[model samples]
Target chain A: MVEVEMNGTTPSVRDELITEIELSFGLLHKAAANFDNRYISRVFRDLGPLRRKLAKNGDALATVIDRLYPHNSASRAYLLEVTGKTDESMDEETKSAVKPEVDLYIHLLVQVYLLDNNRLEELNKFNDKVIYLLGSYNRRSLDFIQAKIWFYISRTKELIDDLHSIRPALLSALRSATLRHDTETAASTITLLLRNYLLCHEVNQAMNLVEKTEFPENAGSSLVARYYYYLARINAIQLDYSSANEYVIAATRKAPQTQLAVGFLQAATKLSIIIELLMGDIPELQLFRKQSDSLEPYFMLTKAVRLGDLKLFEEVLKKYEQAFKKDDNFTLVSRLRQNVIKTGIRIISLSYSKISLKDICIKLLLDSEELAEYIVAKAIRDGVIEASINHEHGYMKSKELLDVYSTKLPQDDFDQRIKFCLSLHNDSVKSMRYPSADNRSDINKHNLAAKEDEMDLLKAIEEGDLDDFMD
Target chain B: MSLQKLTAELYQLYDQEEYEKCQKILTPIKLELIKHNLLLPTVANSDSKDKINDLKIAERILEIGALSSLLSNNYRGFENYVAQLRPFYSNKQIHAKPEKNTDQTKIISLYLLYLLSQGLVSKFHVELELIYNSKQYNVEQDQYLLFPVNLEKHLMEGNYIKIWKVLKNDTNLPCKEYGHFLDTLVNALRFEIAKSLEQTYETIPISNCKGLLYFPQEQSDATFESIIKDDLKMTGWTFKDGSITFKNDDDSHKGNVNPNSINLISNVLSYAERIESIV
Candidate 1:
């Protein structure tokens, strides 16, 4: 293959080039089959030069090669495919066994080009072609391809801020992946769908999907991490900070160390810190040093939250404003200022249990004592501090700290964990599907055992009543 | 359709402000170029002499696409086209004549303005740095590009009056698209002024505000008042005795706080205690 002459002086060289192109096409097909993005991109990159070399030869055999590869043809149909204007006539198959594979490769190439050029119209055309092709074939067998196409479609729509319009395609992708039992695609499609819902602020819909969708048990770690990350975001939005923190922690732990997964981990860590701070607990000191250096801003942000330094927090926000915005964490970061102030007041309450309102105003850098009074009253009401404000004397009085052993808080925490476990079990049961007939018998057996147990309890109760009358 | 005819139709639609129609016409032409292997050249492999004309045509199409996207306020689209044009422009192969490069400057200016209007200060600086670092971008030869650069500097220094003066005195704003972005920039400036006033002053004469904001002489007081009262949501201004007294109200305080900052601390605390007690 490497011996092919670039000048294409002879027939043998041309044949060699054609064979090489065919081999690359075969590799591309395998890559696509395995959903290997890196391998697919590499094959496409390698084919570009070979196709150009064949085009330059300008021989009868070159024309044959062109017919197969079609490097550059002015035909409208060819143009449509290359520019991602899909749904054009697919009548010109090159009588090759790998025709469909070639078609898929060409469509993907054009889609990437159009996407790079921000050509939304052409991208939409490509999406239409994918949808049309899926409908024309056995969709269950084409689940991988369908999932890949939907991923690109959803991504393009998201780039153009048309995420709201991607519901139908995403739903179909999810359904196909689920039906085919393709765990990776199902996990990915679910994540994409959940993200769209979160972006649109449809928290209820996102939660309902989380409850209903049965993620395959063999999902990849990264996909599972994404699931937890999105669940964390949803819970955070719904003000369930404890559950949100748990999910974020799970996500950060399970997230792989790939470049993309690192970003997810960073985001999860950021949210986890915010949630922990909001819960009046400081994130562990080691968390800041554990991640890569790119997460340094988050570490500084954590410090600002811990120290209750409003000025430093604002500075950090302004310095990394673009980064935060890119991560979609700007709103969350902006909301941390209130937490900073609260934390400042908490520190002040601990230091000076009977601080005057004027002193509190100075300590928190509040503009007026009235604002300080309002804040202190709010803190007391919210239970951030075990203290009461004396409106007449303009001072806050802190109560004595209770012993940890005397508190029922630990018992309540156990109950809450149990409740969460029960809910998880119920959700799993609801989402479980008996796709094959063999699984139905297992469910029936379980149902029968439950019924027998209920009958036994009833008989015991009836016998106890008769025994009581005899006595 | 012939590429020439399609290109002509695209310019016509663009001139008439029919951007969507222009895009529709350009798509097929772009596809044709791609099919003919002329849209982008592998410069390392291809001899420049053999494909100069094709490269020129490709460059022209990218320029038109960039302009159309700018006019339509599609920054991402504009960036895509500009990325395609960068190698050509940076190589000094296209637009060899400085005098004939006004369109390039206009596009660059519009891009700068776009960054400024979006409040992307870091990105704006990055773009300007790229231009300064490039060998082809001579400040003296490309003076037309200085408008956005100067405006950005004034914006950074909080010199709104200087920005107003630059916009008012400069007659050479590159193109009509500059006007649209300038309007957005002026709105951002007005917001800054409103915020500063809310922080510093209790009231100012409406006449002084007109001067401070550099409202055009032709614009009526009623227009300015509506912008202030309706668009700015500043109410309870006493427009009497040849002056307007801005009332100190919660609305003014609302301006003092960053409106985007959500109050999650209280909500979090409410749940935090319950969870803590249970834990």
Candidate 2:
């Protein structure tokens, strides 16, 4: 694959690229004329092949541009200028209009082409011009294209390490996306903005952004997953571990189960593990045995945490400090020092009904029996263990473990299950779509002779769905 | 008054340690800034050298507002001023040379300490994320910044002893402004310990309890008792025989809520009625 990409700028490859982009242009036109975004999604579906082709020979982008745009057109001039010197600038002397969708699509391709070629400075300048173009084009069909373009624009700035320079543009873009009720663009920009803030370690600003903005309910799932992942990160950093755990789990569940999304899955998994440890629940050993070498550090760290070994925890931390820092989990992992002690106290409390604070202190390698007592007290208060410390006697005693079925926990669990099932039922019913006029013309007109009953059903659903369900 | 006169006067007042007077003079100057469209650094006003210099003046004014408010014990006002200065610090105009700003660090650390002293741990971590990761702020090297950073670390580690030692050594404090948070922070620290002590001990000599909470032994027992009951809200605690007894809340509340038989019968009857309807 590397060799093929490095083969670089062959004529056949350029021709192949032109054909591919022109075919995608056809898809873009279909999307526009039909007002259907699936064709556009199909166009993106072709992006992987185009990415490979563009990496092989990016010069084809200019040729594709020349053939697509008219001579002396403003967009043509702008695109060619920013694309840098190409092999040739061939243009037809026709005064034809290009669709805005096509224009944004090609601009997105140019961004991908520039980034693939590693022409970051050129890409950065080009993206600035593209941002202006995006602002001018108010076509609703251009929403997805504009969102993807902003992504590449932000990616360019990210590559050039000029994050601050792009903030004003992204903020304004987010405002416009929200203003127009463009859910895709708004969701994309929110994720991009969150990524930018997280990269800068600006958790306060990110949290402020989250508090100020509401994520659109109908956002694409991948973008929602990314948003959830970032939220989990922010919450984890703020020490809201339970909510962080919720978000990370949702992120992993909603993430695309494809090989391409393996990186996201791995990161979310690593975070979930650390969050679980911080919350004083050991992650399962099965998670560590998932057969990835990158998780080796986490695997060892989880081991140390699960065993409740403060010495082992410190060793693991010191050994994997660099890796943890690179993953932005160092501070969170450092917080696990306290959790480790709590877990140690918990284990000791479980084993021995009554133990001296001195013994607990020696086992946890704590500074003194006083520290151990205080730590144990905090653990009890935090619900880590069902135990108490007798300061006067200098001994800790564990309360008798209750029978699980005797408590109200089972009732709460059953209530949660029922609620979940009810929600799932409601969501399935809501998502049940009626046939559009086009889709049902054949089936309803020919196959379904029961047209009257179908109409009654449709009317019931459209007007009285709630009344039917409520009774 | 012009910005120059107001600024100079404000600086003189600050130098004289007349923080209250400085705050009184800050209002009109901030309005003047708004009038000139210089209150917040906008994108248009940040690039050029001349505009950058004007933003610097605005930055200086807000920094003074922050410090003076902090000194005068106007904590909310100080928070607002620091919030207003954040854009300037991040605007890439002032202190863009990657050089350290002593004033910036000192003010930020003060805000951080304020957050810590108030026990806003989440907000404290949020601010710390930026400081620890930003290349511009060397948190470990700057004593002013390091103070709050260390305090937060020890707080998270549940290492209360180190925090007590750090808070007690007044000489270790980097600046006079840091001295302001010490009382509240020490009080907050003791509050943490008092709660822990309540849970950790079923019975303990009052002297040991006082030591655990960092209360001076010379302090009277009545004062300690009142402080615990009033400030810490450990109402279940009993003080007698020169010893403290912690009342386990769970034990007292364990059998308090017997089943409400009326509600239970009503629920069962409703279920039976639904079943009859189904049948």
Candidate 3:
């Protein structure tokens, strides 16, 4: 470590990290004294660059601790011990008092450093101490820091493939967060627990938790988006495709529109495509084109379903079987086999008003006419297509198309969209958070300062709050 | 009786094939378990080996409750038991490792079959997603699990012939309990086929129709017609000249006015009024 730092190239990078840490420490002190979270938010705005630096030179964590803690403080000793580095040349003028916010922030940095370095076992061993410290603090300003720290903790546990043991700690944290009205921590814990449950395929428990708990209305948008994503996943597995479609749509909408969130967008969009296919609706081609990442598997899948080609669907499933399984959409995609045949039958009925069973077999690549007859019959029964079979003649005749103007299909479609828009508006109004410092007397100054603060939080969210989508 | 003594007796009764007596004793035993805090494994009580064993016994009792209800023709009770057993199955303490051909897999598979037989394919798929992904249960290789999984596949593909073979061949059944659902499942399969055949054919030779519905070759046409009409409610069929012809009943309802047009008109008028005010 000393030899690496002695090099001219690395010393400048190390010095830059120390300067940033000192700046962050000043921000933390101001936030702790004024009880203003915006300062902490300011500190997090520069977290992306700081995080990269620390992950490379985690030894800087030792420097931050020594600078922020008095020599005899337990936090300094514990943090230095965790970092496994000691500073013997600390001067008397360098020591500062430790705040819980600073303590937790330093721990958060260590977590990110360990994670990026692939030192999961050390991180795992280090979690108990951090959790104990977190339990001792009851400050509201620590809520955001607590929330982010728990995310890293759960991430470490998940990486170690030990998902169950963290449930007790997370559930207790959720209870305390809610009791203290710590919306950020409560929201983060709920999402972590839901992710844990879904990871183990415990849909029943996840559903019960969702039914029991009321997610804080004023939770951060990223956490809310993740909660919705998990809900969509659970509902999709439970075969509620319509509700699942709505949730996935909400998830994609709520997700941050930044380069950092492209992974989440692709995942949410992939799920949206599958649910749409299951609902017997073809997702627009633009849906696939929206993702910068190659959603080649889903694109191919939608094409196969659109063309009503069962063989192509099979080939795609076979080819991307591992990818689908990795995304945990394998079972849902496997369920599309029936949808493929239904679409095939639908297309055949549309193209030929009256078609023989044998021609249907050949077109569908069916083994025998008997198979095609049964499939078309099932499709009709499932309301996938409007056609009747002539059993003795072994031919199917498409029912005459209903008058589009007279039928209620168009009306129902319009009604659903209108209702959706109304509900979305109602939900937004319900969850709107009023600023506590709303003062009409000095409107101009307050508005300007509020806009700046809002932008800072938004910027911080864009830069450092892709934590929920890390999974 | 002590809870242990009662549990012992229940086990004996289960072994002796006395499901009724076992069910009667099960009610008090569950209450006893609730009294002892061993009903559902929790973090506090499930810490020790003894409590875990007790919970395992509780799980076993619920399994018996589920199986006994099905065997005794109390389907609603069976469903309730399956619901009660879910937490126990999901508890990490009890199902730490995968077990093969145990009563748990059979009970879960039975519930899957129940869902399929009830025509709740959506619910079946939901349950299937959980089972297939859970590390504790191997859906593909397990004997009891594969039956329902394979049944759903063939049913979705509309290969009723494969489903017929699955049902007809008793060897395909993993346990005797599955035999109870055979009649109902066959009836459901026949109903599905009958609906399809009616829509697919104007007239079908009686013998071919009989074969499609899985009727015995020697059964009289009168008997087949009575079963088809009464059971499947295929009233649109008429038998003549060695063939059966379908009467399309949907023709009468065609061209009917939309039932909700008045509501639609009222909504449109309200919208117009609101637009006028805005203007």
Query: What is the C-alpha DockQ of each candidate?
Result: 0.02, 0.41, 0.45
Indicate the worst ten consecutive residues by lDDT in candidate 1 chain B: B255-264
State the TM-score for model 3: 0.84
Evaluated on CA atoms against the true complex, candidate 3 attains a DockQ of: 0.45
The model with the greatest lDDT is 3
* CA lDDT scores, all candidates in order: 0.63, 0.79, 0.84
Cα lDDT tens digits, model 1, A374-411, are 55655654557767555456677786676644444454
> By DockQ thresholds, what CAPRI class is model 2?
acceptable
On a 0 to 1 DockQ scale, where is model 1?
A: 0.02
Clashing pairs in 1: A409-B277, A412-B278, A413-B278, A413-B279
Q: For candidate 3, write residues A227-345 as lDDT tens digits.
A: 99999998998889999998999998998887777788888988999999999999998877766356888899999999889889999999998888888899999989888888988
Clashes in each model (backbone N, CA, C under 3 Å)?
4, 0, 7
- The stretch of ten residues in a row with the least summed lDDT in candidate 2 chain A is A462-471
iRMS value of model 1?
A: 17.4
Per-residue lDDT tens digits for candidate 2, residues A1-471, read 423553455677678778888988886897799776656666775676678677656557766777777775688886766555342544445757889999989898888877887888888878878888888888778887787888888888888898887889999999999999998899989999999999999887799899999999877667788899999999999989999999999998777666667778888999999999888788888887884598898888888877889889899999998999888888788778877777777789889999998998788888887677667777777778887776667888898887666554555466567556556666666677776887677674665654653554444323311100000
Please give the ranking of all candidate structures by lDDT, highest first, separated by commas. 3, 2, 1
Interface RMSD of 2: 3.4
How close to the true structure is residue A27 of candidate 2, measured as C-alpha lDDT?
69
